[model samples]
Target: MTTTFADLTTMRVGGPIGRLYVPTTIPEAVDLLQRVAATADPLLVMGGGSNLVVGDVGWDGTVIKMATSEFDIDGELLTAAAGVEWDRVVAAAVDAGLAGLEALSGIPGLVGGTPVQNVGAFGTVTSDVLHSLSVYDRQTGQVERWTPDRCGFGSHRQSVFKHSDRWVVLEVTYRLRRGGQSGPIEYAELASRLGIAPGGTAAPSDVREAVLALRRGRAMVLDPDDHDTWSVGSFFINPVLPEVPDSARGCPRYPDVKGVKLTAAWLIERAGFPRGYGTEWGDGTVALSSRHTLAVTNRGGATTSEIMKFAAHIRAGVEARFGIRLNPECDLVNCSF
Candidate 1:
């Protein structure tokens, strides 16, 4: 029986798929992908099913869900199947005294999905610790081990799975540090909350605790009871635009590949889209999160169309004011404006 796409995504909104295969093993998953690719029928590879927004009309193709959620650690390295939850991996790493991922404690979604978007939080991004991956290259129908360089990880992005959907992340290997602490706290707000200097280190578990607490405060942590967490996490990646000097641009900038990443939240706020925008009495079907401007939440019964309209309003408003276009972080399917 096919599972409705709504049952699989965090958004809990989508139509039905022609077929949905929950493969329990890597081989089965690979074979299914190969067969689908050979047929040239459209297919989607899903993980914990976070970070997706499928239209109400649903998908017309097959969806292969990776359900191989095994995770293990040998020495300081960690290996996890694509289906493993990403935040749970962080918790495990912290409990094991592994340091590198502590600051990324509350990120949602699956392990395999981490590399897909270079999932990150606080000051820690996944690319910082990823060492290798076992991937099925759909282009050649071959399974191979790939290094971080081959993955083309970037600011909230990676080449391994972006745009092409040509690789099914079977397993991922992370080179985590042992018995040390989190990498330097690069986020000023986090450091201030922890009472440490910027770029300072904290005990791995402490960092995890602090990060989780901070996330909870911001309503970034997933809590089914909280409608704020019902939406995709951070709807937009901070827009990294061409570097204009502070003198030339008249605002702040953070380092990035081409230039600097401007916080989309900052731009949205500056552009006059405040938190809880478009809501009446602070309650609307589709609302900007009260705690964070970057997140668009479903107040209740909000459809993909409503969310898209709100998002489009914000995008146009921001672009008109800041002269920079914002790109959505979630995989927007079947809706175009």
Candidate 2:
């Protein structure tokens, strides 16, 4: 039987795939890409499959599953291959007494995806410690290393690499602080949990443990037996607005470089789509995670269509209740709402 996206993605949905390639090395990945580029077949490059929502029709093209896992730690600098699991990298950093990645301990996905999404957790983001990354420019058929500025990072989870497959990330290097407390904890809940003031410091291991606990509490961490974890961690990006809307008054808001960021989960719950909202809908195969309103989960035997429908309902409800439109944080493949 042919493998399907449901078997690969964390969502456990989607349909059969046409072709798949797992490259164990950078050269092999490049060679595969070059060969695939010579054809008209569509290409989907995936890391951990944590942030993708594919249609039930499935992909009828080439799918490259990054499998290369190699990394090096030179003092405070850590360099990892694109396919290295993100959490493993964080664990390694913490073990080495590195400080920067401790707050992002339990985030899913791979090293290559960090720069693409500017992955963040309780307080720290990938860009906060990124030194540089190497990418293969599909357009030019050349490999180049780029600094943070060239990545076009934004306050929201965005970069030029996201939604565009022009640059294939090959390796990532992070500059962490050697033997020091983690960068000042910027997230209030995490700080409170650690008994530190917001913007205060904590030991790296302590921060990692706290972050893992926080993520586990919200079902953000992966657990094969838990249906609540069978979804993209956050299905919708926190909506950033120039100013807080009257309707969203008293909702949790944070200052951002672009504007004020409002919690998507807050809007989602207040819009009438509470946690476990879709459990009664359709075949009850998909629903908002009972642990968190931000995650739309696959309870069991869910299809891509069902997931999208549930998400669309949540988005529509939030938009109608608040004047803001919610966009998916996960990439939708071969489907749109």
Predicted structure with the largest TM-score when compared to the true one: 2
User: Given candidate 1, what's the lDDT at residue 202?
Assistant: 86
Give the per-residue lDDT digits (tens) of candidate 1, residues 246-336: 4226555678876787778878888888887777623378878888888888777777777787788889988788678788888888864
Query: Where is the poorest 10-residue window by lDDT in model 2?
Result: 117-126
Which residues of candidate 2, in runs, are more than 4 Å off?
none
Q: Residues 230-263, candidate 2: write the lDDT tens digits.
A: 9988999998899999999978998888999999
RMSD of 2: 1.1
**Which residue segments of model 1 deviate by more than 4 Å?**
155-158, 245-250, 281-283
Instruction: Candidate 2: count the clashes.
Output: 0
TM-score of each: 0.93, 0.97
lDDT of each: 0.81, 0.90
Candidate 1 — what's its lDDT?
0.81
TM-score of 1: 0.93
